[model samples]
Target chain A: MVEFNKISGNVWNIPKSGKMLVPATIYASERLMDTIKQDKTLEQARNVACLKGIQKSAYVMPDAHQGYGFPIGGVAAFDPDEGIISPGGVGYDINCSVRLLKTNLSVEEFMKKRHDLIEALFVNVPSGVGRGGKTRVDRNVIMEVLSKGAQWAVEEGFGRKDDYLRTEENGKMSADPHAVSDRAISRGLPQLGSLGAGNHFLEIQKIDQIYDEKIAKAFGLQDKDNVTVMIHCGSRGLGHQVASDYIKEMEDKYGFKDLPDRELINAPINSDLGQRYYRAMGAGANFAFANKQMITHWVREVFEKIYGSVEIDVVYDVCHNIAKMEKHKIDGKLKQVCVHRKGATRSFGPGREEIPDVYRSVGQPVIIPGSMGTASFVLVGTKTAEEITFGSTAHGAGRVSSRSAALQNISGEHVKNELAKKGIEIKATSWKSIAEEAPEVYKDIDEVVRVSHEVGIGNLVVRVVPLSVMKG
Target chain B: MFCYAPINYINLMPQTENMAEKYKFLQHTADAKFQAFGKTLGEAFANAALAMFAVMFDPADVKPKIEREIKTEGKDEKALLYNWLEELLYLLDTEGFLLSRVKKITIKGKVLEAVVAGDLVANGYKTHGDVKAVTYNEMDIKKEKDKVIAQVVVDI
Candidate 1:
């Protein structure tokens, strides 16, 4: 067992363990610790510490949960020269992320037309299971989307051009199609605009609570009516297929017969395994960016169809689970590293060139979505995050129990009815999923976002209560 | 005779009856749902393998004569169990083969080997459930008196 000292109320530090190149850190409240204790999240975090070229420290966010190899809310940085990139670190859902679009409509208008809006959203958005949008892409064009991300969507009239700038990596990574397998390409071709099942959602929400007035104003979320439609999804089935394909192929073919853990299977950052997986993962990420853009367009269309005139603009889109080359100050010198954020988001503070100009003063808006029937938060990045963490924060209220356990405690119908009773409308293809995502199955979002803010990892801006949701 | 679930059913696989008393086949309702039972160490592991495969397909569909071999070594009994099942999951994912039946399961200390057989079904054959990967979570193989029991929570 790795010995860890209680650094703070919610922080634990594991002194370097066996073969671990560095120490490990975990963030969680006493309540959150209960869930962490129930499983091997700490063990997994320590396992991440054992990676070859891991730099600085291996950290787990407050929402950490047990996952394949890395904990769900795990973070680690690897030396660009010596370290390797593992798919488990980034996860199968490649860039599984959250995108928030600001709207001109306010809470009052939304309240007046909530029912119509929710109904329109449910019908318009393609949701549930392998539910795909009507749009289909040919292999060549899909290869384009696989490369271009939101740009492809914009070029295809799915979204506006300005939206790209508001997105991370400008909604596209320089992806090479040849790096991906043919089967992976085939999978991406048919599922270009799709929402895969399990934890993916499209939510309609209003600014129900505001924290930092200045930051909220800067984010254009000051008033009550400022509605936001959050598209929570990622690379979809195509990404899953890609991750699965590579993990299997690398297991036998990578020439590393002795991997510590299969889920932690990886190749050096500059190696063939690393390059191929990154390219394919990037392609899937682009597909996700395009998928969300189209979904945003559909959301805009639904608002137009239902409320006649709705102004929805792209706020900011950021991915939670992804690995990207980033410049972070390490050991007093600035160097490039591959940061793997499994269930965390970038929390770049104040003046990063990557952020849109409008919110430069306040910092990037970090959208922390609450579970169904709970409250989601909007946080602003801070300079403290830059120094302590690798400018990252928690993604959401991580689950405390397994889906089966959730099902045992609550029925899907019961969960739906309960949410409905609270005046929120939820249209789901799988109520069983809703049950699995029951509010009780997760850590409190309020506490999670609060910790992120309190720890100076992220700053609070606004809290939005979901009025309606569509789940796949 | 065994009660077998259809491929086109609500959950991927339904509840099963195991010979071991210490371990029980968990329904789709437990946190670490769906495991195996036995009176000895090997029996529990063998049955756990069977239950995991049945989660993906019907045991009846698995033809036992066609053998698929697997080998694994672990630092301890629990790690061995996890590595063993993880290897099986990899085999299932890559080869398009589901090990619905485990003909034999033998363990010596922390090293073990097994033979399994099953067929792959179409994707989303059971839409109601999507188990991404198996896990070492909540794994426990204990010898309580004359019975041997082990439990694992798979990441579905």
Candidate 2:
């Protein structure tokens, strides 16, 4: 077992040993630490520290769990001139993200038609395994979506300018369609506006409490009982293909002889192969943005039809899996690094130009989606996070139970009944999917958020409890 | 001169009890993990595909209406296995093809060729979830005197 020394209240450290180039750090409460120790989370974090040019410490967030190469909710920054970029570091679903939509309707008003709204979303939003989306587009149009992202969706009249504006990087990045493969394109083409299965979902929530009134107001959550919607998904099959394609290329080129794990195979950040993968990853990220944009359009249509006239606006959109080149303080000097956050959210604090101009004074809004039939939290980024954790925090309540274990222990009917007891409605493609994503299979969201708050990486602004859910 | 067989010819071969004994699910916290056993490496790889499809839906419900030819090359056995499973996933995503069984497979050196049979995901078929991708995490292919066992973990 890997040993950890307590550094402070919510921080633990594993000093550099053997081939590690830097130390490994984990931010979690003692109770959480017990659960985290149950898996390979610490071992993966230590292996990440062994990567070339990894700066400071390889950090694991509060909701971390054992993943393939990097622990989920893992964060590490590598010097651009010296370090490397790994596809596995970014995750299979590139830019798997969460977007929050706020509505003017109150919870009371929403309650009257909760079932109707959820049913409408279920039928209108294409979901499930290997499902084609409602929007049919050819290869050329898919290329446009790859290059333009949400900008393409807005240009096609899928959403408003403000929607992309409120999104991360304006819902577009520097993407090169040439870097993306035809196979990836074919996989992504039909899945452009779909919410592919396995833990991806759409939830209708009501603001249950306000922790920081000022930040909550700035985020457009002014009062308790305000209705909101959350969309959690990613780039779908296109992104998966990109990751698979690159992993093979990187392995063939670099040959993973020095790496501790084969899945941790990487290419140098400035290398040609590395740059191409980054560009391809950006294209994949754009696909996710365009996807969410079209889904947002359908959601708006659903609301407009049900309520006649309603105001539903984008609050914020954040990527859960991605890599970005940014300047951060290292050794008291600002340096550029490639920050890889797999299953983690960027929590940029105030005064960062990367944030939207309207919210720059406050900070980026961090949306932490919970497991189905649970409470989700909206928090603001902090300077402390920027300084220590590379402006990153936990993505969600990380899974505590395996899929097969949940399949054996829980039934879909039982989960649905439990949610109904809490007055939450659910629509899903299959009962087995519901059982696999049972809330009991995950860590407590409340505890995870509390650690982030106490550690000062993210400050809780508001809490929203689900009223209805549509799972893919 | 290869002639296309009727769909009924393929459907006649239901999954054999011996084929059913080839794979078993293992416990993994975040993803689906399984082990497939066969007398030969090619048979092990074929069983791996069956194990992967079993994660998404009941393979018995699918009929072999369509046949897809898959070709891939890798540096070693591990890479070969990874590429083969990924190709199956790609077919599922692009053509909605669900693997009912591997009809034929031949592996020489690091190159592999296979013909897989399955049905398109259509009306009347129920799917549970999506397998995001195949991972090299804890991926192992072991060859013993009597049998070969391949273990794989898929991200869902």
Candidate 3:
């Protein structure tokens, strides 16, 4: 049995044992801890601690769950010269992220054209399995997208100049197109600007409460009834292909005979293959940024068509899965390390140069999306997070049950009707998806965020509930 | 019954028993996991494809209008299975190919060759979930006296 020692009210530690290089620390409340212990979450966290050059502790967020190699909300930092980089650490959807758009309209005004607006969004955004975008591009444009990210979208008249500025890494990272395979390009070519299915969604939400007026105002969420659009998606097939290719390559070069799990296969951070995978992963992240940028453009058009002239500015876009070279305090000195966050978000606190200039004083805006038809949160990063958790926090209300279990117990029609009664409309390509992603399958969002706030990783700013949802 | 010219194999077994017992989905919290059964290793791999496609859309509902030949290799049987499934996913993303059935499959050493039939997703067939990629997590292939079982878990 895995032994745990309570370090504090919200912190628990699994002491270093066996081949583990460091201890595994988990930030969760008593109630969330009970649910977390029911799975292999603690074991996975321990497995992460065994990786080479892992600094501090392998941290598991309150919303942690069982993932392939790492826990869903796992966070760890590694030394550049001695550490390893795994594709599984970054996850298959390279930069699966969330972008929040604030509109000038209020909830009362949006309710007037609710049905028309929902229908327009459903028609405009190409979603579901393997659905291509309305516009087709050649190989040249795909290359540009892999390099320039959201900048390409803005230049093509899809968005404004300041839009990319508010995104993480300015929505663009230095990427080598040559590192990406032809098959990856082919998969990403047609699917650009489309949202693929399974937990990906586009939600129309209205701010219901504000916890911190200063931070809420900083995030462009000032009023309670102000409407916002949240887009949750990722790099699509291109990212998956990059991850698969690298995992195979890594396994071939350095077999998994010594590793605890095959999915944890990796290469040294400074190795040639590691650098190539990083560049290719950056390209996939750029694809995701471009995809969300195009969708934002269409959402702007839909709003302008229905509500006349209006403003829909980007609040912030946070990457949920990524590995980045960052400077953090290690052993009482500032050092550079490669931080991998799988199913987690960077909660960089105040004065970080990576944060946008407008919110630099308050810190980065971390948007935590709840399950479907539930309350989503807007939180600000904390300095405490940087000190202990490598500036990372939970991603979402992690799943507690399987998709098959949800399918067996719930019906799509019943879920739709229940949401309808609560004034939330949902549209999807198939009923089976709705059933699989039912809210009951997820952990309590309130409890998860509460632990984040209590642990001082992410502080609550504002809360928003979905008005309508478009499932991919 | 559907027939192909390259490999003439008749489905003489009863439809209910053959179709219903080919695959069964297992429980996974955040992804799709399933177990496929067959009389031979090749049949088990083919049924694994059926289980994967079933995660997206019903294979029986997809008409076999297009045929594609797939060839892949691995250092071992586990790697071979991983490559086989990833190849199908590649076709699905690039060509919008929805699997209807596997017409023929032959495994020699660490190499696999198969001819599969399906329809383009653009041909008005409604699809639900997207299987992001295949994983080696909890993947297993077991052989018994009269049957073979191949298990897979895919990231969605």
lDDT of 2 by residue, A309-385 (tens): 88989999999999999999999999999999999999999999999998999999999999999999999999999
Q: Candidate 1 chain A, which ten residues in sequence have the lowest lDDT sum?
A: A252-261
Q: Residue B2 lDDT in model 3?
A: 18
Misplaced by over 4 Å in model 2 are B1-20
DockQ values for all predictions? 0.12, 0.72, 0.74
Give candidate 1 misplaced runs (Cα > 4 Å). A254-260, B1-156
Model 3 per-residue lDDT tens digits across residues A1-472: 5789899999999999998999999999999899899888899899999999999999999999889998799999999999999999999999999999999988899999988998999899899887888879988999999999999999999999788999999999889878999999999988999988999999999999899998999888987777999999999999999999999999999999887778999999999999999899999999999999999999999998888887999999999999999999998999999999999999999999999999999999999999998899999999999998999999999999988888889998999999999999999888888888889999999999999999999999999999999997
lDDT of 3 at A196: 86
B52-86 in candidate 2: lDDT tens per residue? 98888977789978899999988889998999999
Q: What TM-score quantifies how close candidate 1 is to the native fold?
A: 0.81
User: Interface RMSD of every candidate?
Assistant: 6.0, 0.9, 0.9
Between prediction 1 and prediction 3, which has the larger TM-score?
3
Give iRMSD, candidate 3. Answer: 0.9
Query: Runs in model 3 with CA error above 4 Å?
Result: B1-10, B15-20
Scored by TM-score, the top model is 3
